[model samples]
Target: MNCDQRAIRFNCLGSSMIGIIDLPERPLPRGVLVVAGQPDSRLGAQRQFAMLARALARRGFAVMRFDRRGVGDSEGCDYNDSDVRAAVQEFCQQVPGVREVVLLAPGSGSAIATASACARIDPRVRALLLLDPRRRANAARTAHMLAPPVPAPAPIGAALFWRRSQPPRRGPSSGARLAGLAEQLCAFPGQVLVVAATSAWAGPTPAQAEVRQLRALVERAGTSNRVQIIDDAAPAPADRAAGGRLDGDALRAATCASWMVSW
Candidate 1:
């Protein structure tokens, strides 16, 4: 599998932002754009994504993975919802012969993918692959600050009741945004794949309940959506040492069914 990496500039948020492109040995029908999360630059740490990109390329798919805004070789400030969405839009438009786009995002990058899908009305985005969907830590912090603190529910029943009784919150609600994105994708007349990571941060076991809950939530939100959960064992010693590099297999699995995979 031959792979070539290059840097280019794409229009994002009305400015030229730098990005990296991973080209395959053979020409591909569709190009996959992988968007990285949080600490940005996945250039070196994204071995799994890199491997999958090469694998997909060998399978006749062109793949591209880039740093968000202020990360890596990109020129711009930090990224937000708008910035991410715009970047995806620009990449989709700039990449030649991109028949379809498969968004592969890990952790908070899922939120960025959702936002981009919601904002762009292109039918080329055939599928969205969310690996380890997580509520943005910043959003959670804001929610906590805005929400009235409950004085430790007196009992389990009370806690449940309190949770049920509260009116469903709305507005730039992260859950709502995610649901909106899912709805949009389902409405796209294409396929959607959601992969949930089953392991918790501190444990060596898969969180079956968590994966089930996430699947149910997506199913309930979009009846036509297709969701899958792959329960991986706790990261091996090598993966633990590599940090986010462990996500390659999950990403490749999610993208294999779509036109191209990106994470």
Candidate 2:
């Protein structure tokens, strides 16, 4: 039988955050809470988040997906320490028999999840599944470097040259941040799965570089076994050629589902 799912509204910092809870007929001892980053609601892009939640629920796991403070039907600005904490509390209270919680965070939400898990901020949080965890952009640093104290007078008829000034190049800071997060999570007493998706569209992608850097950091932390890389090489040739391209989202969902079931 299909699980019972209901829309929920949870109060956070005096505002409401919209969410949905999926409870299996016979629930597992663990529950999952999906935390998405900015610009993505609980549904996720192309409804991938909803699909993954339904899939997991069918596999006998209790699942909850919610919007952050301000996105979707939620109220208030998305700036507060109570985002993940409130959601976890609501999930635990609503789900009757879950003994532990697993946070499934994608994109920049991974950083939030890692910080919470490492700090043991919530005792119920037991594991993390981070997919394509985005590196935090150093906007202040970029702005500082790009905007010089004084601009030299543009040469006569050189307006185009001035317009083409590119922003300052980013250094290894993003990699360093990832390394720090991985180390913290490794020290925590819970399983952490760092998943990297290398391709997005049918062209050269930038996430590949990030994945390499993150993988190196995990290896340096002596936790390379904990990271899972889903790229061109992992899929079978037939799967890759099914539609003359690989479905990155499908691969990611399958990898996550398989790992969670085993965990």
Candidate 3:
């Protein structure tokens, strides 16, 4: 099926922002705004964003992928949540009869989306699909990693243990940042889908605290159903048959779209 893709230029704070809208021949009531992380264009690495837009359009949705100010063809010197809001508004205008809008952000874009959602900048944004939201270990967590594991009990005699001599160069503390991000995301009055790459999933790592906090906050807010997690580990054969491509990302995007379609 052929979808109409149009290159659009819109004004934002006296600067021009460029975006592409994929309009399905037979539109649905939903629209999706695909936000790129810092330093990534709308096309995304390996054209994952483009592929995602096409996939969503094939499923009868209005999808928009755009470059933030100062990136790609957009004219500006900075990028921020305001720029994302501008893009979302532009996307909504291009897709007629869209009753709901979903914000899909991969990587660091998750932070931006979370900020926007917490602020409730746009009421039309009904959900968030965060594919690999940025997560990193904090200084304390790093120290813990460098610390030696506790000795096993006498009954468990085969446990191996090792310790590093010294802690390496310390990175900035990320606990506060990650905690704030999670809080903001949970504050959103809509659904949130967090899709993490197994390679980076925090569930069983030093960064698990932040992920756990997010889940706890969501549950406390009484919107546990509003948050979902997808651990994308081994890529499906179909996704990998494309050769050296970022098939995992494409698969994640497709799965997200399908989930939204059923919503």
Q: Evaluated with TM-score, which candidate comes out highest?
A: 3
- TM-score winner between 1 and 3, please give it: 3
Clashes of each: 2, 0, 0
Better of 1 and 3 by lDDT: 3
Tens-digit lDDT track of model 1 for 12-75: 6665666666665665655666667756464534465666666666666666676677777666
| TM-scores of the models, in the order given | 0.59, 0.71, 0.72
* Candidate 2 root-mean-square deviation in Å: 6.4
Q: What is model 1's C-alpha RMSD? A: 8.6
Q: Which pairs in model 3 have colliding backbones? A: none
Q: Specify the poorest-scoring 10-residue window by lDDT in model 2.
A: 132-141
Candidate 3 residue 53 Cα shift, in angstroms, is: 1.7
Ranking by TM-score: 3, 2, 1
Tens digits of per-residue lDDT for model 2 on 1-263? 37989899889889988999888899888888888776789998778788778877877889999998888889987645577888888898888788788888764544554546533777788777776555333333467677868877766556756667766666667667666665655665666776655544445667677667766766777765654444433554554536667555555556666776775
lDDT of 1 at 165: 89
Worst 10 residues of 3 by lDDT: 156-165
Q: Write model 3 residue lDDT over 1-263, tens digit each, in one string.
A: 57999999998899998999988888888888887876789998778789878878877888999998899899989887778778777877887778788887764534544536533767788887776554322324466678898986553333322223345676545566656656666666777787765554234664344566656666776667766655555555666644555466557656787678665
Q: Give the TM-score of candidate 2.
A: 0.71
